[model samples]
Target: MYRAGGTVTGERDAQPGVSRVRRLGTHLPPVARAPGEARAFVADALRSWHVPEDKACDIVLAASELVTNAFEHGSGGIALRMRFTGDCLLLEVRDSDPGDPVLHRPGPRSVRGRGLALIQALSSAWGHRRGGDGKWVWAEFQLA
Candidate 1:
């Protein structure tokens, strides 16, 4: 289960319902493998939840971006959690760094820095919060 501060402890599932599915994973920092790992993790969860193909694709991409951002700016290990609440799929990535991410406009010649932008454009809603030990970046996608 996840603590009030977004720290993931024991993993558990609630009663079978819209909120029946919950999954969490932790990865070491440097996050070189996080994006791909995140894609697989979210894809598997969404598939189990019977999410539609299109929405699942979007969630995977958004999850990659969130995880990538955490690795880039966050310190120590990172944690990822996914859950269903009503008709929305909520994905959260927590890192030990307390720095808040900033959305910036990249230059024309920029080869990167578009992660958050893609997330903002694709997800129904997204935000971040400072946790007890670090911060968690989250994005939500409509499942209906």
Candidate 2:
């Protein structure tokens, strides 16, 4: 059993042209459907934020890939978080696996091992870090 939580907080200063930040997060069961669930969660959030469809699709795809990797390789629990600061959108997936994800350059006939590469191609930047409980893989997209 897992719970979902979200928080949105931001203020516009007198300097002008600053965007408010919005955030959402959830913990997901480590199951085969986790990737699909993650994609739905992200797509809903982006839609509510009025993110463009094309960009939203890319973000959702990235989230799916991260969640899939976590479900396949991680242990214990999995968590997902998203942040939108107007010009940028950030997606983070945390799992109980301490090992960092690797990006492999697969050969032409390779049947798998392209998730990280797809994420890199779709996102402006992506990385991972070890946490107290596990590790978090994050991706950032610059929105126009």
Candidate number of the best TM-score: 2
Instruction: State TM-scores per candidate.
Output: 0.81, 0.85
The regions of model 2 sitting more than 4 angstroms off are 1-21
Best by lDDT: 2
Clashing pairs in 1: 1-10
Task: Provide the lDDT at 34 for model 1.
Answer: 68
The 10 consecutive residues of candidate 1 with the worst lDDT sum are: 1-10
Report the number of clashing residue pairs per model.
Answer: 1, 0
User: Model 1, range 1-144, lDDT digits (tens) per residue?
Assistant: 112222333244655554444555555345578677777767876787788899889999998888888778876777888777648878888877788878878998999999989888888999899898899899888877
